[model samples]
Target chain A: MSVTTRRRFAAVALASVAVLAVTTACGDDGDEGGSDGGQITLTVDVFGEQGFGYEKLYEQYMKDHPNIKIEERGKGMGLGDYNTRLTQWMASGAGAGDIVALEEGTIVQFKAQKQNFVNLADHGAASLESNFLPWKWNDGKAGDQILGLGTDVGSMAICYRKDLFEKAGLPTEREAVAAQWPTWDAFIETGKKFQAKSGKVKFVDAATNTFNSILMQTAGNGTGYTYYDKSDQFVLSSNPDVKSAWDLTVKAIEAKLSAGLQTFSDPWATGFKQDQFAIVTCPAWMTGVIKGNAGDAAAGKWDIAKAPGNGGNWGGSFLSVPKQSKHPKEAAELAKFLTTPEAQLEAFKALGNLPSSPKALEDPTLLASKNDYFSNAPAGEIFGAGAKDFKPVYLGPKNQAVRDAVENALRSIEQGQRKPAEAWDDALKAGEAASK
Target chain B: MTTNTADRTRRGRPAHHAQPPRPRKARGNFGTRLDLKTSPYLYVAPFFVIFLIFQLYPLVYTFWVSLHNQPLGGEGEFVGADNFTALMKDEQFWNSVYNTLGIFVVSTIPQLLIGLYLANALNRKLRGRGFFRMTMAVPIITSTAAVAIIFGQLYNRDFGLANWVLGWFGVESIDWRATKWASWIAISTMVDWRWTGYNTLIYLASMQSIPKDLYESAALDGASARRQFWQITVPMLRPTIIFTVIISTIGGLQLFAEPLMFSSGSGNYTGGTLRQYQTVTMYLFENMFTRFNLGYAATVAWALFLLIVIVAFINYLLTRRIGSAK
Candidate 1:
């Protein structure tokens, strides 16, 4: 062969190999991963164990449309790993799933990176906005445009040990427990009574956990400030409601109402099993955690009660289509299916993630569902009622840090490193410092 | 044939000098040397090429990001040096700095000291020396996550083996994650458990390399084992000790997985109930992931880099002084 022709052939072969290598690195979801006729595969990444189940849902959806297949990836929970993994994926603009789950605290930051997610309004997501409650629906809104759709609404409730309550002579009946605490003062008095009767068993997890949740539910989440507003500031320091919450918590500690176990630690779970703690202030997802940790010892030994004062929401998640997704339609359809009333209810049964769909709240399947884990407490009815009255709170990107700082300050008081007054100052200082 | 030879001479090299055919080929080889240098670069360029694209590029990109105000997921505007300025004013950052340093001192010091002592003990004519040496390394091979989980269970306040053991000693139940000191203890236990064995092996390796004649000379001079350890053993292990210190410092400063697992409770990412145990890496992670503040997180990473550089510098100075003094 001529030298020039031989060189050309070698160059072509090298080019082909390089192209193959690039394609291999990008990964494949089988040409049929998407439901649409496009060869591109759509993936939706969500956090928690629910990601596993979503894969099945994706497969089911793909069965109907052979051309479109989905690759579902689960990014582990908490704001730490969630942001890092998602950020890396988003930056790559290739590996990012078609749908990405953005948590409440992270939504603002994700919204700021407007290029990462596809504007659903552009892809017929506008009509679905009205399906959710105004506040719940507004969580994913950066402005007029919606960045995500809420998949679950975490309405807060008190999950107490029925056996512990029974032993403490506090009413184990949900009605009786609900009636006992009409106000925050009444709740503190009840806590004192429970402590007096139960001795060393802690009435709740930690002063910080109890105080923060009460502050949110009673005063409403970030009532004094919105993160977006420059004028909005952390009022947990000077706010009377926050002060009262702190005061009440201190009084509980002084009264020796808690077992003093670290919240979310191995000991904490063991405490639940041993019936060492009476009450756990939980949101929607915590119900599953309670059952998982307590095992059979807690079966038929737990009951649900209204959160003290008023109901406030804690955690909920959202799924959005990234702008870089190859098949936007298939991605949206998959997102919609995963969050549909039937699917959400099934997920609720599988995991205690409360459904975001308002229609699902009225579904008889949910209402009739009884958890053998919580002493056969009507899971659907109790969570559904709270879900209805629950209001969505504004969570800023700095919310997690603020929460951490406040918790640290509270720990200072618990450990006797600082007094409540000093801890309050520290918390405010830390929060302000973090905000900057 | 004469015409072909003339053509070959012209194509292979300039024939200004009339020489043997072998000499002409040798002169042509000089040209091939230049081509080898150029062409080999093309053939073996992928490693350097890929390294620049993936590793070096991201590192430089991170430095670029550090200079800007990037939020989580790259949404924020570039506010030059604002994040750095904010970091300076931020107490949490400073607090984290203290936590990082404090953890380094608390965990790394005891770890090295105990490792040296254990390595010395095992070096003697003892029974089951091989068995003991192998057993010492078991902790080193164990996963950090698994160690953290196991220790988390042990540190449990209600029914933990630790608290139960403490109960036998008339000690009251102490909440491990409630206080900063106790949380550090919990975190340090995990650190100490995982790293002490690895350090011991290094110390032992250095110890085995020490000449027996030196120890004999020390003994002949009537130096006791303790005296020998102080003078002969310690002085000889200086270089190894310096190496271990640097390793421990870098590892210590970047202490993330242990404390993170402790905080998350479920091995998730929440920084414990109190966040008393949260480190700088955890804070950076939280900022980047939980908060989606990429700019803030990048700022944290750069600060960590500077801190690590400063730490490594200080360690080098200290080690150099110690080495010279010994």
Candidate 2:
């Protein structure tokens, strides 16, 4: 080949590769929606064990709206990873799905950046307020702008191993177990008694998880807020409910009832298989996680009982449409559909995520439903009852960070690395630092 | 820059001299001259273009964002130097720095020593030397997540191979994630497992290049194998040793994965219950991902970059003194 020809060919190859790279990096555009052959794809971002249990709903929605295709992402993903990615996408003004699921803790953080979301109140959501629980509907709103529609409510319960409870000479039936612990003090006494008879099996999975459940329950019933008040003040040091919950958790740790495992960790998962801990703080959403982690062998060995204190929420999520979505109208419609009373009942059957809708909670089908995994403990009725009594709690923008600080402090005590007093002081300081 | 010029000169002669027998059809043509000047740049443009877009842009942008109070999904206020000033006094930031250095020292020292000994042993005539050399690469080829997961199991508090072995010696099982030193040591071992073989291979390759006659003459002069290893092999592999040392310094100071995976649990960016083994990079991620403090995370990133540069420079100085001490 001629030198010029060879050089030209080489230059052309390099230029093409560069062009290919630039083109590939840009990838597909999000703007293409419902234009080509009247078909469009809607991406839904969700997290946790089974991703909102929306498979049947998605299939039904697509069959109804033939022009729209529904695709869900983030199945089997942890909330932490999902939130981190969602935060990046929100900040960058792109890359987020058309409809994104936000956990209760996450929604509080996103409430500070409410402009990124398409206010659902503008899209007929305000008219549908009576369809949901009062607090559930209000929690979706920032002032008058509604950012999301409530999907599920993580009502509190206590799931204990029936075999272990029987071995420990405690009541194995759900109603009898509920009668054993009517208050936090009674719960601790039960834990101590269980510990005395149960060898190599602790009362609870981790002090931190149980502490958070108690804190949520206490803060919900008493103050109706957590680390922050309605005005978003840092109240960790001043909140009487927080200190009482802390003291109650400290009492459990002092009684040596904790298994010293971090929830959702690998060791914690292993603990389920080996029956290392007799009980775990079970929110309505956690039943799915427990079923998956405990495997088929532990079926019928677990049962859900009433939580010791008043109803509180530890999790649950909202569905929001980002402003960056190319088809916010369609996204809002889909989100609204997924959160309807009928759709929520379908999800309740698929996963134990309790319906946030008051009508759905009162549905005869939902009330009759049983979780075969939990020994047919009337999972629907139990979670439904808890949801009815749960009061909404206000969380601040920096709630997760501050909560992490408290969880770390609790883990420190669980590891036997810090005194309760020292840990409490550090938790306050760390929480303050984290909020900054 | 000088090497590029020298390389052009050296490469320029081969084409010119080798092509002298052929007719120079476009020797004096303008297009040919322009092609000669620009085509070389075109060939190398992709690397520089990629570097500019990915590496240099992010670096400059990081410094710019470090000055602001940037949260996710919001415009940042330019509070110049406030982030840096706060970072200077921040105990968690300082703790991360201290942990980074502690892990770097604890891992790199034993890593290099073991690497040297392994390289020295592999340099000798042994059966199945090719197999042994290839075996050293297995850990490097293994996915980081797989390595982290396996090591996570090994260091687990309740049931782990490490604590199980310790039990044979009548020692109590250690909660690897509890204390600062225990977590650091566990993470350091993970680092060593992955990188020691890499350093060993580098040393082995460099050692093979050294003249074998020096070792033969040393043997004739009544020098033992240990003495020859220290005096002869050590001095000859100074540049390679320094190279490995500098590389390890950079890797160690920016430690993230080992410490991160070592602390299991959802949202576990703190490294431990008390930030015991939280390195600078992990702290950066905690700020960026967990806390959503974009400005603070950028500041942490810049600090980590400066730290790696400073530590790598110090490594250069210390490793340069190795053979010269003779």
Best-fitting candidate, scored by DockQ: 2
Q: How well does candidate 2 reproduce the true complex, by DockQ?
A: 0.60
lDDT of 2 by residue, B1-326 (tens): 99999999998888777765655576557887788999999999999999999999999999999999998878999999999999999999999999999999999999999999999989999999989999889889988788889999998889889999999999999999999899888888899899999999999999999898999999999999999998999999999999999889888888888888887786588888899998999999989877888999999999999988988998898889887888
How much does each candidate deviate at the interface, measured as C-alpha RMSD after superposition?
4.0, 1.1
Model 2 lDDT on a 0 to 1 scale = 0.90
DockQ of each: 0.29, 0.60
Task: Specify the CAPRI tier of model 2.
Answer: medium
Candidate 1 local lDDT, B1-326, one digit each (tens): 99999999887876545565454477779888888789889887899999999988987888788777665455458788888998898766787788778878889889999999999998999999999999888997888878878887888756678899999999998777777788788788789989899999999999999999999988999999998998888888888988998888889999998887675443234354445667899788766655556778888998998898899889978876653575
What is the docking quality class of candidate 1? acceptable
lDDT of 1 at B76: 54
Steric clash pairs (candidate 2) = none
Model 1 stretches with alpha carbons more than 4 Å out:
A1-41, A49-60, A75-80, A91-94, A220-254, A259-262, A308-310, B1-24, B35-59, B75-89, B214-231, B266-278, B290-296, B321-326
